[model samples]
Target: MSRFTELKREVYEANMELHTRNLVIYTWGNVSQIDRDASVIAIKPSGVPYEDLKPEHIVIVDMENTIVEGDMRPSSDTKTHTHLYRHFESIGGVTHTHSSYATAWAQAQMGIPCFGTTHADFAYGEVPCTAVMSDEQIQRDYEEETGVQITDAFAVINPEEVPMVIVAGHAPFTWGSNAAKSVYHAVVLEEMAKMAYLTKTLDPSRAPLKQAIIDKHYMRKHGKNAYYGQ
Candidate 1:
């Protein structure tokens, strides 16, 4: 078997989980897992239905977004995945999803505010939104530019602390230490987005989550002082 067979299978399962968890519809999402030692990424193929996807259908690409294995074309968002793998040194997986609630926030060009501890548990604070791409950027290689936009949005935030970002007018993209974790983040992000939206609708005057609570919830689940998850 090819060395990448295992990586491909892992990525395939992650992508399948997106569908299984109802995080995606049709071919609206993709997941990629990076093999840092090999400097390659195994990602979903472009436009393929998740139901019919197989492990071999996963495309393996390098950091430069060059196809290194597999017969199928890499995902349209392949550049975004590659750019993130190159820039976000700590993340080993990337997921792009058009999940409804999260995509609603993205379309509104708003961040998911830290409205409660549930959100703070995963993200230190708000889940940030990227600035809209310039017309020049939109007109040329939009996928690559999307990657740049995501990286630029994280200039002040620690990717390790907040693993998710919503693209202005687009949708959410999440990353983690591996493909499965990235998908997990996507699921949590969607739930948080739903809660935040309901919180606003129910109490428009609700204040953003207090910093002290944010710090406590976030730290308890992350950092050396973390005490969450046994």
Candidate 2:
């Protein structure tokens, strides 16, 4: 198959996965994948339902968020994704999902700490929740400013310990080298949010995961001699 065909298929499948996981309702979520050389990104069109998302319906846009192909408009979150793809050199895919539990945490403006092996398996520390945007900035740039808010939040905190950042009062934005990995992170984030909420309900002051435990768990599967899928 040609590269364009594959890129189109990937964008379709990733959008479908959002509906499959019930992470979105109506048209609340979006997914995008960069070209083989990162020249452009193929994203879901705005306001289109999951049932009707087709490869022909996918919108191709440059890193500047200008449309390069497709007839329909790109997702409203295009600017946010474009900013990430442009600044984060290693990232090739970006996903935004209004998944319930995760968004709930974002609304609370609290980070998801590593409290169990499941959470530790992916991140070494807490999953950060960014600060809510200032009224002036929101009034100025809105979505584009969201990208700036998150990026600055990471700089204020630390990303080596937090791969996922929940946009305060909004949803989760996840990224990886590809769409599949970004979706994987989103799903894991929802599950972890659920677990964290439940644990805190039982004990309001529960502590985070120990450094040794988090390190061991992360290294075992991601490091040597870990027989997970193999």
Candidate 3:
């Protein structure tokens, strides 16, 4: 059996969860999980429909994006996933999806402003949107540049605090301590995006949730005094 058997299985299930959650249609999304100690990641194969994917089909690649194992081609976004792993040492898994509402926010090139406590409970503040990719960046390396766009937007924001982002003119990417958590964030982000869109449509003049409330909600779940779960 492969040493990466368990890692591949976990990543495979996470990818399936994206489909199960209705966050992806056809082959529109991918998920990856790193085995830091092994310097490898098991990710979904390119163009494989969720209905047909199996644990053995998961592709394993090294930190430098070289194929480490498996017969299939890793995700076309493999470079972006590798770049993020190289840069964000703290994250263990990453997810990319074209879910409707989050992608709508990305297409509009707008950051998701915090409009309620539900948003604050997860993201500390606005879910940032990356600047549109430049022609040079697109020509250079589209996927790697996508990773650069995300890291650049996070120059001030902590990935641990805000686990999700929307690429301008693209879609959403989320990361977390593991594959399941990353998918959870992806679901949370889509819901937040939907709610924000409706809130704006209902009251275009609605102001952002006040800072005091943002701080309160965020802290209750994430601060040193966090008391959210059992």
Question: Candidate 1: deviation at residue 126, Å?
Answer: 0.5
Model 2 C-alpha lDDT per residue in residues 1-230, reported as the tens digit of each score:
33467787898898898889888898899999998475889999999999878888888888778888888999999999888776676777889999999999999988888899999887767888887899898899898999997888777543434557789999899887788778878888899999999999999999998889988887787656765665
Cα displacement (Å) at residue 80, model 3:
0.7
Q: Candidate 3's residue-wise lDDT over 1-230, tens digit each?
A: 99999999899999999999999999999999999999999899999999999999999999889999989999999999988998899999999999999999999999999999999999999999999999999999999999999999999999999999999999999999999899999999999999999999999999899999999999999999999999
On the 0 to 100 scale, the lDDT of residue 203 in model 2 is 92
- Clashes found in each candidate (C-alpha, N, C closer than 3 A): 0, 0, 0
Whole-model lDDT per candidate: 0.96, 0.84, 0.96
Best by TM-score: 3
Q: What is the lDDT of residue 207 in candidate 3?
A: 89
Off by over 4 Å in 2: 1-3, 36-38, 156-161, 223-229
Lowest-lDDT window of 10 residues in candidate 1?
221-230
Say which prediction, candidate 1 or candidate 2, comes out ahead on TM-score: 1
TM-scores of the candidates in the order shown: 0.98, 0.92, 0.99
lDDT (10s digit) by residue, model 1, range 163-196: 9999999999999999999999999999999999
